[model samples]
Target chain A: MKIRESSALILPPYFFLTVFFILPVLIILILSFTHNRDWSQGITLKNYLLILDPLYLKVLIRSLIFAVLATLGSLLIGLPMAYYISFSNPKRKILLTLLVLVPFWTNFLVRIFAWFTILGRQGLINSFLLWSGIINEPLQLLHTSGAVVLGLVYGEIPFMILPIIAAMDRMDISLLEAATNLGANRFMVFKKLVLPLASPGIIAGSIFVFIPALGSFVVPDILGGRDSFMIGNTIKNQFMTVRDWSFGSSLSIILMVLVLLGVSAYLRQGRDQSMTLGEYL
Target chain B: MSHRDATSNVGFGQGKSVSIVTISGLVFLYLPIFILIVYSFNDSRFSASWNGFSFKWYKIMWHDGPLWTAIKNTLIIATANTLVSTFLGTLAALALSRHRYRFMGVYHKILHMPIVIPDVVQAVSLLMLFAFFHFTLGLVSVILAHASFSISFVALVVMAKLSNLDRRLEEAAMDLGANRFQVLTQVILPNIWPGILAGGLLAFTLSIDDFVITFFTSGVGSTTLPLKIYSMIKFGITPEINAISTVLVLFSTLAVSSIHLFDREKK
Candidate 1:
């Protein structure tokens, strides 16, 4: 009887998700195999072959480099930020955590756009430099590949910080005390105990930063110049401008596969096999 | 051990160096937004050098008819999306936590599928689906795209709330001879009401701020505020865009502060 009632409750989401998410994903997958939406011509490997071409391949490789750099930068910066909070007084911890989270709650595009003032040719750094006699000409800060990486790291730091903080909060404080008492020095305790214990969070944080950075287009499009085009731009161009739906679908499938790999790794690392929103906040 | 000595011995907090790094990280996160807000009021149009403060940009934004239309469309989409997603998402949370069903694990995976994939890919897929069905590109399509993505988020928040919920209240209500439905509606639902609200608020925020998915699914003449902001960008950096961003940041701060207050009051 309880099952009967519960099934009724479950039916809406199942139906809703089926029509909107699952079916759309299936359509795209099927669409990828067609010859530029001319399915009557039968399935072909043309789209996949197009993606493998060197001109497109450069974009894929460039995106990977940017993502990897952004992930590493986030980890380097976010680790210390998380450690400070995890080890702080209870009252201060809440305030500190909120400082990290405030940026996250705002508009993502606005955050990227915020950098425009600081990185534009006539922007902050350039104006300051000129006034101080540091440079005769305005330095080109915006519209560069480095600016894209900066936007990504800045955007993704909250994701990296919160998870590591959660992990550190969950850690056994006594283990660190025991190690110190057993003649392990400060460095040894961090290396042997705190760092190892925080490894799961580090992995989770890396996955969080890497996946979005990998698929990003807005930051690149806004901050980067023409040469800095990523795979996302390529896909968007194909679907919207070129109207090559088959090629775009194939690209989407590849990106989907890469993201799924990250999700599988996250699931494997997390003992609960799920990430809850409460923990993120 | 003294508090200072204990922290130092643990070696995680090297005190000054760690403090500096943490402060710098916070500054890096905040500095851009701060500059953006300040620049919103700058009188000069071209030079990055500030002239003086003015309300010119805000005034310009006020008279922009298209901006008003976008705001109307955005509010409608976000409000409706929140209602539908929160309802479906709360049911999903209840289903996962309270009841046993066949293929529950598979259903759990299905719920998370939207969240794990890239938004750009999700947008492309939905665009294809809508195009295949000859569905008109407009407000309705945008709502579907946003809701499909926002549902998992709502479900996750409510599930977190459920995990921390006490089941004995429901059992005691039943012991007092209340029907099962009464136990649920009276006991379980009331206890998790804050969680439901939190989920709703989150869904609303996601729908409002979403860009990538909305970019694809939205038809011509249909625009959200984020879409409006992007269109503003193509014309170059203006004080008007900064003004809009400042407003968005302030609004989000207000929303987030209320959530914290509500959560604290509940406790």
Candidate 2:
């Protein structure tokens, strides 16, 4: 009786996901192999072969580099930020964590655009530098690869910080007490005990930041110059500008595969931790 | 790495260097937003540089017809997205938390697919889907696109909340001669009310802030705020965009504060 009832409850979402999510993705998979939108030309590897061009290969490499840079930058900042909040007094911890999270609630376009107030030619940094006679010309900062990485880091750092804090919260004070009681110094306790305990969050954080950075479109489109094109820009241009639906679908498939690879790695890591870290970004 | 002994106070690495990194790290996160908000009131039209304060941009953004149309479109879509996803997600959450079934493991993995996949991938796939069916690229399509991703998130969050629920309450209610429907409606529903709200709020936010999906799914006359803002920014940065951005940032702050307050009150 209960089984039947549970089936009834699950049916709505199951049907919804089937029609909207699963079916759509599957349709695209078949569409990727075809010559045109209607598939009148039949299945072909022509679309996939087109992806082998050196130019497309270079875009993939550039995309990986950007993703790696942003992930590393986030880790460097998130670790200390997480530690400071984790170690604070209970009263202050909540407020401190809140500060780290407020930016996330904003639309990402707004967050990325905020950099304009600081990085644009007539913006804060240049204005200050020009006033002080530090440089005769305003530096070109906005339309550069560096700015894209910077935006990616600034855009997604909160995802990295929050997970590490969760891991830190899971740390038992008794473990620290036991380690110190066993003749370990403070640094030793931190290096051996705290760091190891925080590994899961660090892994989760890396996956969280890395996946989005890998597929980043807006940051590059807005902040990056022509030379800084990532795979996302290529995929978008294919569909939106080039009107090449077949190639766009194939490119989308490849990007999805790459993202799925990262997710599988994350899921493997998550086995020990389970679904606690599964909050969708 | 220097000034190590400074961590001796409270012993959680409250070192001078740690404090510097942490505080500066926070400044990195917040200072751009601080500047963005400040620039919204600037008198200058094109440059971000201050030319004293004014509300001229706010006046312009207020009267901007296209901007209002986008905002209205966003509201309609977000509301529809939230309502449908929350209902379906709440049911799925209850099913996952309260029952065991065949192929549950596979079901769980598939559920995570929408969550883990990049937005661009999801967006293009849905575009293909709608195109294949000759579906009109408009508000309905955008709502479907947003809800596809939001449903998984809503399920996950509500599932998290449902995990801690006491099954005994439902059982006891059933033992009192109540039917399964009565037990669920009277007992299980109240217990997971917060989860539903959180999931609904989350769905609303995801729909509102979404750009990639909306970018693909929306057609003429179906622009959302993010898409409108994107078109504006591409042209150039103006105090008008800054005003719109400031309002967005303010919404974020309000959301964070309310969540904080709600959490405290519940506790």
Judging by DockQ against the true structure, name the best candidate: 1
Cα deviation at A226, candidate 2, in Å, is: 1.0
Residue A146, candidate 2: how far off, in angstroms?
0.8
- lDDT per model, in order? 0.86, 0.85
lDDT per residue for candidate 2 within A1-281, as digits (tens), equals 24344778888888989988888889878878988565677799888888789988888899999999999999998898888788776667779988987888889998998898889998889988999999989999998999999999999999898888888877777677678778987688778988899998888889989999999899999999898989899989988999888888898889999999888877776586733643533
What are the DockQ scores of the candidates, in order?
0.57, 0.52
Q: lDDT, candidate 2, residue B204?
A: 98
Sliding window of 10 residues with minimal summed lDDT for model 2 chain B: B1-10
Clash pairs of candidate 2? none
Q: Candidate 1: where are CA atoms >4 Å away?
A: A1-5, A182-185, A270-278, B1-14, B172-177
lDDT of 1 by residue, A180-260 (tens): 789987677777887888877888888889999999988898888888888888899999899999999999899889889
In the order shown, the candidates' Cα RMSDs to the true structure are: 2.6, 3.3
What's the distance in Å from true for residue B180, model 2? 1.3
Docking quality tier of model 1: medium
